[model samples]
Target: MVKKMMQRILPRAFLGKPSLLRRSATASQSTLAQTVQENEPVLPKMPPFDYTPPPYTGPSAEEILSKRQQFLSPAVFHFFKNPLNLVDGKMQYLFDENGKRYLDAFGGIATVCCGHCHPKVVDAIVNQTKRLQHSTILYLNPAIADFAEALASKFPGDLKVVFFTNSGTEANELALLMARLYTGCQDVISIRNGYHGNAAGTMGATAQSSYKFNVVQLLMPSIHLTFISSFACVSKTGVHHAQNPDQYRGIFGSDGSKYARDVDDIITYGTSGRVAAFIGEAIQGVGGIMELAPGYLPSVYNTIRKAGGVCIADEVQSGFARTGSHFWGFEAHGVVPDIVTMAKGIGNGIPLGAVVTTPEIAKVLAHRSYFNTFGGNPVCTAAGHAVLQVIEQESLQQNAFTVGSYLKQRLTSLKDKYEIIGDVRGRGLMLGVELVTDRQLKTPAKVETLHLVDQIKDFLVDVMDYTLSKM
Candidate 1:
């Protein structure tokens, strides 16, 4: 009875052939151990943290992709041929279905500053939602007032007044309107590769052909008053695209003063002498993380101010301590803008944006009745408040400085080794690596870039498989 029970409990192979069973088990264990040991060195050591993502039991990537195709906009594109069905996120990491973890290097297109679902931010959102979810800006809400005050403290000069919006686009639109109203001018100047937004008002300011649509031109009549009415319409609220001061591939090689000369020439030749605003991203986020040439903003700001234009810094991607060295990207450039538009990281993925300017400049909106129903909603403002607190408490700005400098050094080393790496630029966490076919010509190596992305995906997959096998 004892022997029968032992045989039943043991492997079938062990019943008749103990040697075979032992060999099979030993071989399998050895193979797995060897694989784990070989690949273990490649795995990035997790930072000292207690948080772990919950298990994902959702639909597969294929199902999600199919549903997305059926229900979502056709314009909505995805990265990776095998799209990542991300189900969860934490600080600097994202988890896909099957619990495969990935380092979120892109940070949701430079939006997730504090990380995905930060505990404090989530708690604040939940608390606010439980108390009061929605309220118009017209009504007195402490959340808005509190967040506005906190946000204002981060800025320099007289940029104290705040106007809440749902996105960077709206913030920029408001900034443009303020610039137009304050200076009584129409024409605006934007850098060639700079992206402001895609809304009707901002689309004109955005120079990229890919982002612009035919409807953009059609909407201009209704959007810009100068376009419809004949009031010094020689400039016509038209957006003049200035030559981007691309140090890597520009006419002038890192000579920011030379680039600023182009702005002066643009004002002289392109627009009416006077302009509304000169708006630019300190680091062009959507324009491949391009940093402005040194001394470019100061010179341009001087020129634009002389031309009756306010210097508007679009801090949508480079704000909220993402730049590492300073609280604002403009600070790194050593120039203070008259208007600052911010979003993305401000609310830590919550839909919130703000335009900050002087009390004097912000008064332009008060001349006419203006209101936003969802702007500065209790939940969003609460989340924004928590984000600011988290940044300070966690010392994320210093982390960005330390980690970003280390990352930049490593990337610079990679650039030294690889000829395809044309340029590695950007400040702090907001960095970009551009690939080129020729070092001299600086032709974009599009195919090579795609190949590199694929290689990374494969490597990540292998690492994930190894981890799962161990588990």
Candidate 2:
């Protein structure tokens, strides 16, 4: 319904501006009409009239909020609040139904890579719809093959086989299945505060209280959850003051230096040399953007691999050039995983996800009956390809790095000025600001954090409202 409205409105918008177009004459016609002979390719002229947007006529914020309360869903109960009736989105902005825009710093939890509805992604989707949309995986789809090739080529070794899913959670679930199938073991190790997904199987892999509490039961009973490290490698969770040590701390210090060592010991001696997989996000996302120590990931992967286990990098939140310095977050740490699960920004806002793995693991998972209905649909793959292309062409990943650094610097300054910021850390655009009540005893200021978030949203609404009124 919304798509139809956009098509009608956009074409009318394009045609209405004759002056915006430039006409070029054909070679033969140009000889006859010198005035039109500008040595340019022949094209239709644009109509003249300033492109004025149709004014927003949706429900006001208050009215919409009131109405949302009446239409409840189990999904909404799971998230932060009622999802916004977002009317339009463009680079770095999400316009609410009332046309108020937000800066979109969080990028919808860092899913939007280039930006919301990037022009290239929009054009790709529009063009793809006119061609083909879906084809069963049972039959061959050229677009899917092309996407798989390009995606695999980006990686180093034989981590090449690709499987598409509708979301990151699904991707991780598939990757987990692959791990178990290959290792023939049930126990898996995930870092503390790390989040994989909300689905039945993936939920068991995630080690968050919030997600775990509401879950009816352990959907994947064999899965084991373990804490790798706190938000900042602290002794306990929450806001606590700790000197940001410039040096690498071994896993056997006054701090939980032995945290990773202990985990390794448990996986080795405790589990008696049997472990299925070690799954981790390149950077913890819902776990508050905790970065892995410089050598932490590689060390853990080596430990797991030596135990005949697979190491899976859950790149759902951290892939697709969101991590500025390198396209993949794991790249920054100089470690490669046996399998990589991805989503969020893969389609630049289109619903898509994937698992890229070594041929060995891929073959094992293939033997198991695994299938995704909308996985690697032609249209979605086209959008995905366009997004990847745009990120490179527009140097958006570089933008994420440079602009993200600036944003982080600004946040760091804010942290110094305000006592509430406990720690500010992240790479490229995948950044987080840990809030605390007291610097010394780092207590998470949950209420204060929510208040600040609300304040930021309110400010954007006010500023955008005033700007629109002037126009």
Candidate 3:
């Protein structure tokens, strides 16, 4: 068995920096804003502490390689074939065992929303652990109840019921179960290139083949795949518009001619077997953070609902104000889903997931005996509460809109400058820069993209070491 090493611990900062908006605003404006702001005087501004207990930097890369390889655990996924011996992280930065910090552009696949190890989140976790940590699901926990209420209030309509889980996959899994039971249908529809999760039930809902191709032996039954159209919108004369107004155009009816008819044809062909549910990510996460075209989700949801199928929005990556303009990505499309699954940024860095649905849907899923040992335990729920509070108090959602827009603007400009950049898309901080060999052909520059990624990694690792040199 591979042995686990004692990973370096990074102490939580007790205080946070003053909100930048406060610093920038005039005294009068700041006073007025504070009065109206829901939670003024957010987290206390903390000074940066000496993260290093002591300094001892002697190993070079060659030495570290030999040492690390000797202690390497086979259990790790080895992302990008490089084992990132991460030691600590703060705000949008991660540090390796060697005390090198990285910009953390990926945000652990868009999980770290309020930055890493936020003071409020850390304080909640630490304080809650002192009072109560793990509480059985059989008992009602105040923290989880508060968290559920806060989360429910964020969404539209009656998405009040919540089922807590350990990860996005679990959330999606629960969502699948809920949808099936609610609709009383066996067949599930997933948009092509849409990723749900890796669980057996969710894997069935996932349409991406790359992640599920080898798992054929364990794949679930009654899974149906359909394309969300990627075709560009054109005028009657066939002159295409560079930007399509509708994001979900391709999935339900992307054929330029007889789009609805094409959808109807598929629905009719599949009708012999009733579709229990249709699940899709509000915004495709791994499938390039691709936003749905206008009228796409609404049309698809309507179609699925008309077919007596419940619509599920897998908001694992697109929920909780990450998309800038709206609180949820589905809201952007004006489509309301029967079920919504979420994780990642919900509890900041804490491991937490939730499946929110209408009472009508929840009542149906209640048939199966469901229990989680630690889902929505006091501490995790407290952390989630803290995260939501931070999001509101600091106006992080608005920040996501402003800063994310700025970042996107910069990235788009970069795309214009760099011939290798094919497409730059995403809302707020959840952006993607698709690198391509030829802009005209839109050929993905895989090699160049990898090289650029490496360059960025190196720069972050070497140049950003000072902040966490002793971690």
- Top TM-score prediction, candidate number: 1
Model 2 bad stretches (over 4 Å): 1-53, 59-67, 74-84, 213-257, 461-471
Model 1 Cα lDDT, one tens digit per residue, 1-471: 212211222222122323222323244645534433443334434334455678777789999999999999999989977888898887766778876667566777788888888889999999999999996887888998999999999988899998899999999999998998888777889999889899887888998888998773412354455354333324644688999999888889788999999899988988768788899999999999899989899999999998878999999999999989998999999999999999999988999999999999988888898888888889999999999999999999998887778667666765543455679899888998897767767889787677567555644434433332332
TM value for model 2: 0.77
Cα TM-score per model: 0.86, 0.77, 0.75
Best-to-worst ranking by TM-score? 1, 2, 3
| Cα error of candidate 1 at position 284, Å | 0.7
Candidate 1: lDDT of 27?
A: 49
Report lDDT (CA) for all predictions: 0.79, 0.67, 0.65
The TM-score, computed over Cα atoms with residue i paired to residue i, of candidate 3 is 0.75
What C-alpha lDDT, on a 0 to 100 scale, does residue 154 get in candidate 1? 91
Q: Give the lDDT ranking, best first.
A: 1, 2, 3
- Candidate 1, superposed: residue stretches over 4 Å from native: 1-52, 216-233, 458-471
lDDT of 3 by residue, 381-453 (tens): 8998898898899888898898788767656664432345567788977887776655556677776566556
lDDT of 2 by residue, 1-471 (tens): 212221222223223222212121222333323322332222122222222334678787667666667786534532234356667776756666655555566676677887777778888888878877776778887778888888888887778889999999999888877877687665677776678898876777777778875634333332223432221111111111112111122233233233546457666444546677788877788877877666666677777788778888989998988889988988987888899999988987788999999887788855658778889888889888888889879988888888678667766765443455678888888888777766666778787676556544544444433332332
Worst 10 residues of 2 by lDDT: 232-241
